[model samples]
Structures are given as C-alpha cells and as structure tokens.
Target: MNRPSIARPRRPRNHPDRFLECQRAVEDTVVSAIGEASAAGWQKDEIIAAMIAVADDMQLALNAKVLLSVETELGKLMKKYR
Candidate 1:
C-alpha cells in the first residue's frame, strides 16, 4: 500500500538557500530568546546554558529531518526495485 504523502516545508536539494534561511531563522529565534532571558536577569552562565540547550535541540531536529528524508527516499527506491 502506498503511504500518504505529508506536506512539509522542503528545502530544494539543488540549492543551499533554503538551508541558509533555516539557519537564519534559528539564529533569530535564539537571539531573541537570549535577549529576553537576559532582560529577566538570567546570569551569564544561565544564558550560555540556555543557548547551548537551544543549539542542541536544533541539531537534533535537523538530524531527525535528514533521517526522515533519507528514510522516505530509501523506501521509494525499495518499492521501485520490487
């Protein structure tokens, strides 16, 4: 049975422009969060920790997206071969 396609924001594989846009969006979010945290009197260490946590979360999310894309392509190849 064919799996239903889920619509997602896909970055074109032929260009890095969308990838850069994603990075810029992440950076903007992190900066804004840090500013708010600082304004709330978060200490330097606390702010750095928050930044690191955000970065880690972003990396994990990116990795998961790449894995999902690879898995979908692999499934397509398998079906084509079968």
Candidate 2:
C-alpha cells in the first residue's frame, strides 16, 4: 500500500509587498498619465487630485488585518523559493 504524499500547502496568493509593488507601478503610470493629461489640457484639476489621493491611500493606508494575511502568505512563498 502506498502512503499518501503530504505536500506542504501553498500560501495564499495575496502578498502585501506585492500589493505595494503594484501600488508603485500604478503610481508611476498615474504620474505619466497626469503629466500627459496636463500638457494636453484634457484632465480636470479636481479629478487628478482625487485619483492621486486614492493611490496614495492604497500604498500607505493598508489595513493591519489584511496586511498580516498578505505578509504571512508572502513569507511562505519566499520560503518555497529558497
């Protein structure tokens, strides 16, 4: 009789640092877009400010519960690669 293979379970896919990296990439894109929009005079000041504010919040205002979940999962993934 063959014993069952007990592979270690994978961690959750949502990573906190990954989220932060996404935030950075988004912010960069937003900056480029905002600059182009400003030059083209196609964007409103209030709209631009609102979008930037939302990005900043996502980058910095991460909820503690969610952050813990993400960071723990990331730790597992990192361990897997090592």
Candidate 3:
C-alpha cells in the first residue's frame, strides 16, 4: 500500500530546533491523549486501538482525501469504537 504524502511547507533540512519542536509537539499530543483516555476509563487495548485508528485516519486527512481502502477502514474502525 502506498502512503499518501501531505503538501506541507518546506522546512530547513538541517534545523535541529525545528525538528525538536515538531517532535515535542507530537509527544505532547500523545501524552495528552493517553491521560485523557485513562481518565475516561479506557483499557490498554482500547487506547492502543484508538491510537492506531487515529494514526491511520490522520494519514488520510494529510493526503487531503481518502482512498477507498482508507474509507472502508475508517468506517470499520468507527463502528468498532462506537
């Protein structure tokens, strides 16, 4: 399966500060998600599945459109979560 690429603005290739900033942002988001899920009484498997589903959806979103397989997977995931 081909992964879709997002059209993002070019960043400086050698910029450690920018790279660290982006890494920190992703880490913070993930930490926040874990805390919220735990507070909401989610089990480990539920949280892991949710994270996987969201990561897959994010890829579709970044591509600015969803392919057929992506759409099907998203629907299945939503139904499972719901």
Best by lDDT: 1
Worst 10 residues of 2 by lDDT: 1-10
Tens digits of per-residue lDDT, candidate 1, 1-82, equal 2223333346775676877656655665666666777878997779989778987999999999999999999999999999
State every prediction's TM-score relative to the real structure.
0.56, 0.37, 0.46
For each candidate, the alpha-carbon lDDT, in order, equals 0.75, 0.67, 0.72
Model 2 agreement with the true structure over 1-82: per-residue lDDT tens digits: 2223333324444855665555554665566766766667766786588777996888766776688899999999999999
Error in Å for residue 23 of model 2: 0.7
Q: Quick one: best TM-score, which candidate?
A: 1
Sort by TM-score, best first: what order? Answer: 1, 3, 2
Better by TM-score, candidate 3 or 1: 1
Instruction: Please identify model 3 stretches exceeding 4 Å from their true place.
Output: 1-21, 64-82
The positional error of residue 18 in candidate 3, measured at the CA in angstroms, is: 5.3
Error at 59, model 2, angstroms: 17
**Backbone collision tally, model 1:** 0
Candidate 3, position 2, lDDT: 26
